[model samples]
Target: MPNVPRKPRKQVAALPVMVDPKGQVRVLLITSRETQRFIIPKGWPMKGRKDHHAAAIEAQQEAGIIGRVHKQPVGGCNYWKRRSDHFDYCRVKVFMLEFRYQLPDWRERGQRRGAWLPVDDAADLVDDPGLIDIIRTLPKRLATKHKRLALKPATMS
Candidate 1:
């Protein structure tokens, strides 16, 4: 086979975690608008929003979710996008969001469905190996995050 040049991958921001009232960490998956494949809510960089904020916006638009998005990415993964007759490689940076209220209606409410699951179940549900690895580690990351948060008050002095 002849070697073919690959196009530069595009960047996207993804929001994958949701913390429940009981402190359980759940991962959110939304169906892709085009293929209905399960994926985290994701989108291209918005005009003025920061990367994580853009991810937050995607979470809202795609899943009717509103939450506090962490400034740093939890992980990244590469996937392919299908257009009319071509595939484009896309690199996604995933961020974690602290769960908050969900709106009854949102921009993409009719276009997709969102589901929350345990880290292991989420890993099984998503297609990307990179995402699965991140999902598998999310529980541990959440534990560390909660530990740090629990210590914040005592350390404030």
Candidate 2:
């Protein structure tokens, strides 16, 4: 018998961001259930939803956030999902979700903690280099998109 390699599992994530009253960009991050480490909300793709929509759903479930998700993915990152016996390699596509409103209470409320942090602080909290890069480049990417769309700017309140 010969061994064969498995492909990386596909996943989706939502990068939830907002500009505060001071016009400072901030990102929302949730603590992982097991490790308690800061991470963006992500999960396996839903059967009936688009990738970006699924990412939005993940954000709602994991972080209790609802927002407008960009149709296009900004970037992707590969990570190792820990399992009981071994680790599974996963590639996650990241979508930017414009913050709308937060629920007073929602599912998974007590299981995890969510926080809004400055982009640089949020990037520094995450462990993955690829994810870090995405967070670090977010402000510029967002500004470019707003410019391309002919919007006033990304200094949304």
Candidate 3:
């Protein structure tokens, strides 16, 4: 008898925090048809594509935003859920990327709309505090990086 191979685990990436020029920290939240709950924009990674490419595509399709992904990965998380008919816990890695543009015509996407809110307000909007924690940390991290760069000595020509 031949043995059947198990299906691969599912992985998803989410962008939990974004920043504006004003230095305000915000999160891009999406409401899906299957789930009424507001979740950070995310989707399964596409094969043969870079992580950031998947992230960018997910943002455009799910949130109707066209943007560039940051090079750094803020952090990742793991979670579990049932797969097919079998009950299983799957590990999903979360990523944080800032949406580089505003959605002037988000209605065109026809999937869902998104909004940017203060990190604190965003925390209140989402059900999971863990996600909120991720959003809240972004501002401090970006600010610290900016400060360090500003303090660096100027390079000689």
**Poorly placed runs, candidate 1 (over 4 Å):** 1-7, 21-23, 147-157
lDDT of each: 0.72, 0.83, 0.58
Q: Give the Cα-based TM-score of candidate 1 against the true structure.
A: 0.83
**Best by TM-score, which number?**
2
lDDT of 1 by residue, 85-152 (tens): 77667788888776666777789877887777767788898899988898898878877776222111
How far off is model 3, as Cα RMSD?
9.1
lDDT of 3 by residue, 52-129 (tens): 677666766666665556544566544444345654443444566555554554443555545666777777877654
Q: Return the lDDT, model 1, position 81.
A: 67
Clashing pairs in 1: none
Error of 3 at 133 (Å): 2.0
Question: Candidates' TM-scores?
Answer: 0.83, 0.88, 0.69
In model 2, which residue pairs have backbone atoms overlapping below 3 Å?
none
Error of 2 at 69 (Å): 0.4
Order of all candidates by lDDT, from best down to worst?
Answer: 2, 1, 3
On lDDT, the stronger of 1 and 3 is: 1
Error of 1 at 52 (Å): 0.8
